[model samples]
Structures are given as C-alpha cells and as structure tokens.
Target: MSLLIIRLLVFVLVFWAGWRLWQYWQGFQNQRVEEQQGKDGHESMVKCEECGLHLPSSEAIQSGKLHFCCSEHRDAYNTPPRDDKDN
Candidate 1:
C-alpha cells in the first residue's frame, strides 16, 4: 500500500509538471505572435500624398512610386488631360 501511494504521488507530480510546462510554452508562443504583430503594425501606416489621408499602407494605391488614398485621386494626378490653351 505504501509503494502504491508513492507511485501515485510521483505520477501526479510528473503530470502536474508537464501541464505547467505546456502552459508556459503556450504563453511563450502567444508573446512571440504579439511581438511579430506589433512590428507589422508599426510598418502598416501610410500617408497619402494627395489628401494627406493616413491609412494602412496595404490599402493605399501606388502610382509613380507614391502612395495615394484611392484610385480616383491617383488617376487624376497621374494623367491630367492636357489643355491646348496651356500648351
């Protein structure tokens, strides 16, 4: 009976230790993911040249190596119809 109790205690201790280790590993992984997201979020902001609209860089339109708020503004600035009088 004493040997069986000792074995049970050892098993319980090992199980508890494994559970705690798993929890720590999960926490570490979550922290890593958050850090990566923080870095990406810092790089995400973009400023629009036309209207000065600040937004995510991924959603902005790129033209002539410049970022624009939308396609309409980018197109308007890119190819303005030439006026004969101005020419």
Candidate 2:
C-alpha cells in the first residue's frame, strides 16, 4: 500500500515536471520564431489600421488587406457611422 502510494506520487511529480518543461520549450520556440521573422523584415510585422498599434502579422486580424489588433477594432473599422442617416 505504502509502496503503491509512493509510486503514484513519483509518477505525478515526473508528469508535472515534463508538462512544465514542454510549456517552457513551446514559449522558447515561439520567441525564437518571432526573432527570426523580425530579421526577415517586410510584412513580417503589421500596423493595426484601427489603433495604429503594431504587432506580428501572424497575430493580426485581417479585413481585406488591412490588419487590426483584434476583432473589436476590425468590426469598428468596417462599421459605418451611425450619424450617416442624419447627414
């Protein structure tokens, strides 16, 4: 009984350690990829057409050829003025 409990604890610890390591490696790979894209230049990064914020092109939301930081910005950008009817 005691031996079984010890083995379960050991397994859990090893599994936890491996999961943490995998997460760390994934983050490292993402950072390395971002660095490589920066070196490549030209359209690897994009400016948000709405807020003028810049980010990696891969992360930007696209409407036609223009990019936005998020869906809200994209929606806002495409939406017409409410006062257009008053004009």
Candidate 3:
C-alpha cells in the first residue's frame, strides 16, 4: 500500500511539472509575438519643415522632399517671401 501511494505521488508531481513548463512556454511565445507585432506596426517620425513639429510620417503632409504638419503650413512654406526693397 505504501509503495502504491509513493508511485501515485510521483506521477502527480511529474504531471504538475509538465503543466507548469507548458504554461511558461506558451507565455514566452505570446511575448515574442507581441514584440514582433510592435516592431512591425512602428511608424517613422518626421519633422515639419514649416513649424518644426514632430509627427509620424504617415500623418504628415508631403510636398516633394519636405514634410508639413498642415496644409496651411505647407502653403506658407512653399510661397516665396515678399521683397520689401522691391515694394
């Protein structure tokens, strides 16, 4: 009877250890996947040439090689400055 009890306890202990290991492995895999997704979803930041505002490239307005925070800024930057001497 004692031998049987010991065998049962060992089996339970092994099963518990295996279950814990499986749980840990699943958590590790989930963390890795989350990190990968974060990296893939990252957007590059750009500076607006007009206002010097920093924002994601996806949201910035692009005019040739320059970036702007808004249409007004883009227009303001693109328009040539008035010459006071000529006026």
Candidate 4:
C-alpha cells in the first residue's frame, strides 16, 4: 500500500510539473507576440506633412522630402512650376 501511494504521489507531481510548464510556455508565446506587435507599431507610423496626419508609412505616399496622406496631396505638392518658383 505504501509503494502504491508513493507511485501515485510521483505521478501527481509529474503531472503538476507538466501543467506548470505548459502554462509558462503559453505565457512566453504571448509575451513574444506582444513584443513583435510593439516592434511593428514602431516601424509602421509615419508623419504626413500636408495635413499632419499620422499613418502607416507603408500606406503613405512619399515625395522627395515629405510624406503625404494620399497621392492627391503628394501630386498637389509636386506641381513642377510651383515647386520651381519656390526654389
């Protein structure tokens, strides 16, 4: 009877350890995902000069030295005759 109790106790301990390990692994994965999201957020944002719109750089139209919220704004700023007179 004592031997059986010892075996049962060992099995329970092993099960508990495994459960704890799984929980830790899940937490670690969640932390990694959060870190990746933070990095992506930092990499994504860009400032638009035309209307001071903050948007993802990937979605913004980029002119020579500025970011625009859309192509229309970029083209408006890119008008050659007006740009030339200003320079």
Candidate 5:
C-alpha cells in the first residue's frame, strides 16, 4: 500500500510539472507573438530626404511634403550647398 501511494504521488508530481511547463511555453509563445505584432503594426514608415534613413512616420520631422529623421537633417536638406568653385 505504501508503494502504491508513492507511485501515485510521483505521477501527480509529474503531471503538475508538465502542466507548469505547458503554461510557461504558452506564455512565451504569446509574448513572442505580441512582440512580432508590435513590429508589424499599422504605423507607416517614411524615409529621410537627406540621409534616406527609414523610420516610422510618427517619429519623423515633416517639412511640407518632405520627411526627415531629425530637425538637423531637415535644415541640411533645405539649405543649398555652398559653391567652393564660385569663390
């Protein structure tokens, strides 16, 4: 009777461990899916006119129809290059 009880206890422990492992695996999978969904979310992407770097439109600086990564890039793009040959 003691041996039978020990066997039953072991079985219950194994089942509990398996259930915990399954729960952990499911949580990990769900977290990965949520992260992937965040990366592929509805926000549109824009390219910087000066550096051509791509970033989310919401973070970009917009000047008229042009989009830039930062204010410096926008200013640089708007300013014409100085002519060294003309001097």
Candidate 6:
C-alpha cells in the first residue's frame, strides 16, 4: 500500500540522520583528545652541550643551534678553553 511505503521511507531517513549525527560526534571527540595531548606535550628534554647536563627546553639557554643550562655555560662553551703558558 502507498501508506506503508511512505512510513518505511520516513523511518529510513530518520535512521540515516541519527547515524550521521553519531559519526560527527565521534569525530569531534577525537579532535578534542588530540588537542589535549598537544597541551600535555609541553615539556621537552634538552641536553646542555657544555656541561653534559640535561634540562627542560623551556629553562635551557638557546645559542644558535646549541642548548645550555645557563648563560655561564653558554658563554663558557662558546669561548675556547684557556691555555696556561700563552702569557
């Protein structure tokens, strides 16, 4: 009957719309998880080229491509080691 066919079509459309909405919600949840992970990844370990010390990137001194724990270490590393008999 024509009524039966119309009811079936309406049910199918509603089911399809619900499935699409669920898929969209799942995608949004995945995006939120990725953003949370990015924030938690802030701390990065870096090694001081001068003293062989390890520290977080945020606290490490950056000189060109090298990393140091402090300005003293950075300066010491950049300057050549002192020689005793050069005076």
Evaluation by TM-score, superior candidate among 1 and 6: 6
Off by over 4 Å in 3: 1-39
lDDT by residue for model 3 (24-43), tens = 99999988876754676566
CA shift at 27, candidate 1, in angstroms? 0.2
Q: Write down the worst ten-residue block by lDDT for model 3.
A: 34-43
The count of backbone overlaps in candidate 4 is 0
**What lDDT would each prediction earn against the true structure?**
0.84, 0.89, 0.91, 0.82, 0.91, 0.89
Error of 3 at 21 (Å): 26
What TM-score would each prediction reach against the true structure? Answer: 0.48, 0.49, 0.51, 0.47, 0.51, 0.50
Cα displacement (Å) at residue 13, model 6? 36
> C-alpha displacement of 58 in model 5, angstroms?
0.7
lDDT of 5 at 85: 96
Question: On residues 1-86, what C-alpha lDDT tens digit does candidate 1 reach at each position?
Answer: 99999999999999999999999999999888767657553547778887889987768898767999999888777887888996
Global Cα RMSD, each model: 5.0, 8.6, 7.0, 6.6, 5.3, 8.4
lDDT of 6 by residue, 2-82 (tens): 999999999999999999999999999977876754667456689999999999887899999899999999999999988
Candidate 2 positional error at 18, Å: 20
What is the RMSD of candidate 2? 8.6
Q: In candidate 2, which residue ranges exceed 4 Å CA deviation? A: 1-43, 84-87
Reference-based TM-score, model 1: 0.48
Question: Which residue pairs show backbone clashes in model 6?
Answer: none
Error of 4 at 72 (Å): 18
Q: Which runs of model 5 end up more than 4 angstroms from their true locations?
A: 1-40
Tens digits of per-residue lDDT, candidate 5, 17-86, equal: 9999999999999878767557654567899999999998879999999999999999999999988996
**Candidate 4 lDDT over residue span 1-87, tens digit each:** 999999999999999999999999999998887676575435467888767889977688888768999987787667664445756
